[model samples]
Target: MTANPRGPNAVDRHVGSRIRLRRQLLNLSQEKLGEELGVTFQQVQKYERGTNRVGAGRLWNLARVLDVPVSFFYDGVNEGAGQPGFSEGDQTPIVDDFIQSADGVALAQAFARIKDSKVRRRILELVRTLAAEEAEATATEAAS
Candidate 1:
């Protein structure tokens, strides 16, 4: 089993993305995370980009520091990917995408700070309504 020299493996990328997501969710900067890991910011960037593969011990350390289990990084990995009969699917990780974006993060932070449960439910309903309307508008535009 040989890895491609062009880029990181799928599993490595997934693990790195999970690390990045957790770090972002905690509002920790790359430098802060690097400091905790005793590594430079650039090294942390590399790790998050999957340019460097994380070793088992380092991954465990990351899990400890991030307050997640080591298995968090491997949460969505296909059981038999890179095998003869199994192929990796092209599904976008929507939660990771949302977590990685500034607007999404800001929205989440603001929503979390709204301490009232009724207000939170109302906000959720509003967002759902807006999304449904937007989707309908897009479909109508496409049909025109």
Candidate 2:
């Protein structure tokens, strides 16, 4: 967004995009999300636009309201986002990649199901391990 002076501004945009995306994915209006988070729709709008920082306390409330893990916001913004001199190569993020995949949508739906708490936890663990193994296999095959 026009070179954000290199600070939390960058992270803000990422988190903001995530908040907006997740909110939209759940079909939640800003007013609804604001009510859940004890804020105003204007506040939600500002947060989603990255015009204001999301504090940890508010973030926790957001996680509960959004029914997401707090790490969800930081998932895509890793070392890749910490480029010393940002370039077009670093423009795309893990979150962006995740959102582009049909698997991501399927995963979200699966998460929405699993009424059993233990089953949900097990499914997450299993899927993570399987995805890791599959990715490793693909990388190895590529190298070969």
Q: Using TM-score, give the best candidate's number.
A: 1
Query: For model 1, what is the C-alpha lDDT against the true structure?
Result: 0.84
The residue-by-residue lDDT of candidate 2 on 1-144, one tens digit each, is: 555564456677678878987887887889999988889999998998788889999999888888999999876674655354654255685757666345775577768876999998898799899999999999999999
Task: Give the per-residue lDDT digits (tens) of candidate 1, residues 18-128.
Answer: 898889889899999999999998988988888888889999999999999999998877676435455556665677678767688889889889999999999999999
For candidate 2, give the lDDT of residue 46: 91
TM-scores, all candidates, are 0.75, 0.56
lDDT of each: 0.84, 0.79
Backbone clash count, each prediction separately: 0, 0
Which consecutive 10 residues in model 2 have the weakest lDDT in total? Answer: 80-89
RMSD of 1: 3.2
